[model samples]
Structures are given as structure tokens and as C-alpha cells.
Target: MIPAAFDYKAPTTVEEALSAMAEAGDDGKVIAGGQSLLPVMRMRMNAPEVLIDLGKVSSLRGISDEGDSIRIGAMTTYQSVLDDASVKEHLVLLHKVVETIADPQIRHRGTLGGSVAHADPAGDVGAATLALEATMVIAGSGGEREVPASEFFKGLFDTAVDEGELLVALRFPKHTGWGAHYEKFVRVAHQWAIVAVAATVKADGGTISEARVAFTNMGDRPLRATSVEQALAGASATEDAVRQACASAADGTSPPSDLNGDADYRRSIAPVLTRRAVLAAAEA
Candidate 1:
């Protein structure tokens, strides 16, 4: 398939990129990594009149530790993230989940901000950020504003990143010493998850003090399983207790049925994966 003809602009700075987007108005699309947008364009699903490329934007591509939180630039690649010592040491859940996204080549090219901005329900990174309660830093002509991960994803392929705005960085609160795990259910190697769970728990004296459970592909967007979190809090960090808590894994989800599996099948397997993820985190 061939995409429609469109104008393109490669900006080296945030200001230039924003100006380009403002000039193109609603007909422009900003591209970073091109992993998600290119495929959509080739299929004729989107035919933007102008394409603003952020490949040359140096400011949007690095990892910085800011005392209590880590700020990851929007254009930073997955491979870069996987290789960062700060992420591996403090944000272990994110480090574990990113290793499962696509393959090495895709990881080298795909950007974290791109995935978050794309807001794909099946994307692994979003669930981890949601579970960690990260913050999104958005930049536009009016200046910059921070949006919480919980309020960022509005629906399937939808987000709070409005027109003329760019996601510059993601700020994650440090989760040092927390036990974390990402449980992904895929049909084969290098495939998107049919259903995945991200679990992070803080345990004390063999009892769970706090827990954050998030699910991917369980709804129109990455969802926090509040019911499961509540069930696990204050419970013993044991397999039996984890299984009992995970029984409500699919209670509030609206999972989609596709070639991979039906809604009922996903619903039935949610608890299984949740239990596994929770137990792994507890044991870690």
C-alpha cells in the first residue's frame, strides 16, 4: 500500500517542531521513531497533509535522574532505556517490561514517548507507567504542563495530548527496593501480548503492605486493577492469598475479542496471569 503525498519537516529543536505543527494546523502529524505512525499511514488509515519529524531533536533523547524521580526524554529509544543503569536500578518493573517489546531492531528504533503518545491498549510500557503513577510532561505553544499517567490515556488510541502539543518527557517516581514483575501472555515469540499484567508490591514481615496492579489489553486503554490491589493489600504474601486476590482480575474490564482469543477466554486467563505476576513480585 502507498500513502498519500504529504509535506515533511525535520526539526532539530522543540520550538521549531512546535512552530511547524502550529503552521500545519490540524492537518499535520508529528513523528518520532515512525514505528507506529508509518504503518498506519501506509494503510491509508491516516493521510496527514504535513509530517513533522522529531528525529533531529537532541533535547528529546536522554535519561536524567532528578533526585526523587527520573525524567526520560520522549525521543529516547527502548534499547537506550534497557541499557540505562538508573532505570534498571530504580524502575525495575519498566526495565522488565521493556525487554519484551517487539525485538532488538524495533527496540532500537521505537521511542518510549511514541508508545505513550500512541496510547495502544496492548503496549507494554503504558501499563508499567500507569502502575507506577508516572507523570507526562507535554509542551506546546502555550508552554508546558504535566499530566498524570492515569489521566493521560482517555480511550483506545486516544490521549490527552491535544493538537499542537508534544510529549517531551515522562517523570517516574523512584521505586527503589520495591519487588516488581511483568507477566506477559503471548502466543509466540516477539508477538504482542494477548494479555499482560504488571505488578509491584511492597512487602513487610511476609505481609503485603502496598500493591499496584495494572493490565494491558483489558480495556480501551491500560487499566489499573483497583479491585485486585485492594484485595492484596494487608494480605499474606503467599500463593493462596495472591490467587484469591486475583479472582477479580477481569471484574471491571471490557476486553476486546480478536484472532488471538475471545473475550471470555481473555477474561478466564486474566486471573491466572495476575496471580502469577503478583506471586513473582512478592517473591522477588
Candidate 2:
């Protein structure tokens, strides 16, 4: 299907992009890579008066080490994150999650910021970022402000990015030497996760010291499995221990019922996937 006609502006700078968005007001939409938005537009689900493209925005397209954390530009592609040495060494969970995001072509074109900004519950990036406690940098006409990943995702297809604001970058604290794993369940290869878990653990002498667990497609937003995290602390890094801790993985989630599966089905499998994810992370 052909999308409705709209004015397009390819801005080279974030400021220019923001200005375009501001000028377009509520009818303007910001696009990066167009991996997610274009499809929606093509189906006539969204028709904005002005389309602000950030593809040429140089400032929003790189990765940098920020001492204690790593800063990834909003336009940084999934493939770039998978290839970065710093990401592999410091943010292993992110690298692992990025590796499972669709196939190579999607990975090359999908931007990290774009995925988070789109805030799809089934997306692979949001749960990992929520588990890592990443921070989002948003730019607006007023100025820049930082928002934590927990607060960044509001609901399905919704985020903290307002009408005239743009997500500039994401900052993730270095979790060096941490064992990380992303457990995704899909009926077919590269399909959106029916239920997925992201786990990153820090262990000492075979005992689990700390852990972060979050789920994708378990709710309207990426949900942190706090009960599981609390239970894993000071527990043995073994299959039985991880399985017991993950029993409550779906306790508070309200998963959607769709053609893929019903809410009950997702809830039933959450713990199974959580156990696999946590144990693998602990062993990594």
C-alpha cells in the first residue's frame, strides 16, 4: 500500500531535526532508519504532515566510551552494536540481545534508539535496556533531559518522547565481566519474540551475587522481573536454584492474547524461559 503524501526533511543535525519537528507540531513524525515507521506509514496506519528524517544527522550516529558507561547515539544500528569491541566487553547483555534482533538486513537498518523509541513490547532491545538500567537522552526545543529506561517506556507503541522531542542517545553502565544471555522464544527464525527474557548476572565463587531480569512481550511494556531478581540474590548458580527463582517470572505481567498465543500461554512459558535465561547468564 502507498502511504499518504507527506513532506520529508532530512536533517543533518539534531537541532535541525528538532526544529523541523517543532515546526510540524503534532503532525510531525521523526524517523530513524525507517525500519519501523515506514511499514506503519505504508499501511496507512500513520500519516503525518511532515516526516523529519534523522538519517543524515551525524551527531546521532556513533558509539563512544564515557568512562563508567558507554554512550550510543540514537541512530546507531544494531549491527554496529554487535561489532563494537567496547559493547562486547562491557555490555555483553546488549550485544547478546542485538544478535537476536531479526536477521542481518534488519540488524543493519534498525537503530537502537529507534527500537526503544518505538517501544514495541515484542521488540528485543527494550527488555535488555531495562535490565541494564540504561538511560535515554532526549532533545527538545527547551533543551536536553535524561530519562531512565524504566520510565522511558510508557506503554505499547508509546514512549516518553513527546511530540516535539527527539531521542538523542542511550547510556548504559559498564557491566564488565558479567554473565549475560538473551533467551527469546519464537515459532520461526527472526520472528518477533512470543516471550523473551534478558538476564545478566554477576557471580562470585559460584554463588549469584547480583542479577537483572526483564521480559519482553510479557506486558504492555518491557517488565522487570523483580521477584526473580530478589530471589536469585545469594542463591546458588545452579539449574534448580535458577528455576525456583524464576517461578514468579510472570506473576505480575498482563501479556496480550493474539494469534501467536493467548495470555495464559505466555504466562505459562515465562518461567521456563526465565530459568533458561538466568542459568545461561550465570554460566556465561
Candidate 3:
């Protein structure tokens, strides 16, 4: 299917891209990587008056190590992230999760910013980022500002990035000694997870000192398993303990009943996967 005819502008700078978007108003769509946007356009799901391409915006694509955190530019591809030494050494949890997103070919084109901005609840990256407490950077006519991951995602296919605003980067604090794991349940290779869990555990003297747990496909947006986190904190790092805490994995979630599985089926498996993830993270 061919998309509707539209004007396109490849901007080399953030300000220029914002200007194009402002001019196009609500009918403009900013695209980078095009891995997500192009497909929607081809299917005629979105017909923008102008497509602002950020392909030439070199400033928006790279990984930089700040003193306390790693700043990942919005246009940074999944493949680039997988190859970064800093990410592998300091943000190992993210490294593990990125390895499971789609296949090699898709990874080379899909951007972390695109995936999060698209706000697909089933997408794996959101859960990992949410668990990591990453910060999102947004740029618009009013200049730039930051939004925490907890408040960034609003609902299914929705986010805090308003009209004429572009997500420019993501900032992840260094995990240092923390151990993390991403557990996904996929029926086939490189398939979307029916239900997934991201766990980061910090152990002290054989006890879980701190724990962060987030869920994918559990609600309208990536959700922090606060009940599980509270239950696991200060608890012994054991399979039984993790299992007990994970029982609340589906407590506040409203998972969808789709072709993948029904809401009840997902609720049933959440604890099983959460246990596996927490156990693996605790041991790491």
C-alpha cells in the first residue's frame, strides 16, 4: 500500500527539525530510523502533511558517558548500544535486554528512542528502562527539558512527548554493582513477549538490599512492580522468597486479551517469569 503524498524535510539539526514540526503543526511527524514510522505510513494509518526526517541530525545519534550516568542519544540504534563498552560494563541489565529485542537486522535500524516514544506496552525496552529509572530528554520550540521514565509513558501508544516535541535522548544512571536480568516469554524467536519481566537486584551480605521490578504487557504502559519490589526488599535472596513476592505481579495490571493470549493466561504466567528473572538477577 502506498502512503499519501507528503512533503519531506531532512533536517541536520534539532532546531531545524523542531521548526519543521512546528510549521507542519499537528499534521507533522518526526522520523528517525524509520523502522516504526514507515510501516505505519505505508499502511495509511497516519498521513502527515510533512514528514520531518532526522536522519542527518548527527547530534542525536551516539552514546556518551557522563560522570554519573550514560546519555544515549535518541537516534542511537539498538545495534550501536549492543556494541558500547560502557553500556556492557556499567549498564549490563540494559545490555542483556537489548540482546533480546527483535533480530540482528531490526536491531541495526530500530532506535531506543523510537521504541520508547512509540510506547508499545508489549515492547521490551520500556520495561527495562522503567526498572532502571531512566530519564527522557525532550526538545521543542520552548527548548529542552527532562521527564522521568515513571511519568514519561502515559498509556498505550502514548507518551509525554507532546505535539512538536521530539525525544532527543535517554539518561540511565550507572548500576555499578547491581545485577539485572530480563525474562521474556516468546512463542517463537524474535517474537513479541506475551509477558516479560525486568529485574535488578542489589544484594548485601546474602540478603536483597534493594530491588527494582518492571513488567511488560501487563498494562496500558510499562509498569513498575512496586508490590513485588517492596516485598523483595530486605528479604533473603532465595527462589522461594522471589516466588512469594512475584505473586503480586498481576495485582494492579490490566493486560489485553489478544491473539497472543488472554488476560487470564498472562496473569497466570507473570509470577513464573518474575521468579526466574529475580532469581537470575539476584545471583548475578
For each candidate, how many residue pairs have backbone atoms clashing (under 3 Å)? 0, 0, 0
Models, CA RMSD each = 1.0, 0.8, 1.0
Candidate 3 has its poorest 10 consecutive residues by lDDT at 27-36
Better of 1 and 2 by TM-score: 2
Q: Name the weakest run of 10 consecutive residues (lDDT summed) in model 2.
A: 13-22
Show model 3 residue runs off by greater than 4 Å.
none
Point to the candidate with the largest TM-score: 2
lDDT of 2 by residue, 1-284 (tens): 99999999998988888888878888998889899999999999999989998999999999999999999999999999999999999999999999998889998999999999999999999999999999999998899999999899999999998877889999999999999999999999989999999999999899999999999999999999999999999999988888898898899899999999999999999999999999899889
- For model 3 the local lDDT of residue 26 reads 83
lDDT score of residue 177 within candidate 1: 85
The residue-by-residue lDDT of candidate 1 on 204-283, one tens digit each, is 88999899999999999999999999999999999898899899899989999999999999999999999999989988
**Candidate 3 C-alpha lDDT tens digits along 1-284:** 99999999999999999888888888888888787789989999999989898889999999999989999999999999999999998888899899999999999999999899999999989998889999999998888999999999999999999987999999999998899999999999888889999999999887998999999999999999999999999988887877888888889889999999999999999999999999999999
Evaluate all candidate structures by whole-model CA lDDT and list the values in order: 0.95, 0.94, 0.92
Q: Give the better candidate number (1 or 3) by lDDT.
A: 1
Clashes, model 3: 0
**Residue range with the least summed lDDT across 10 consecutive positions in model 1:** 201-210
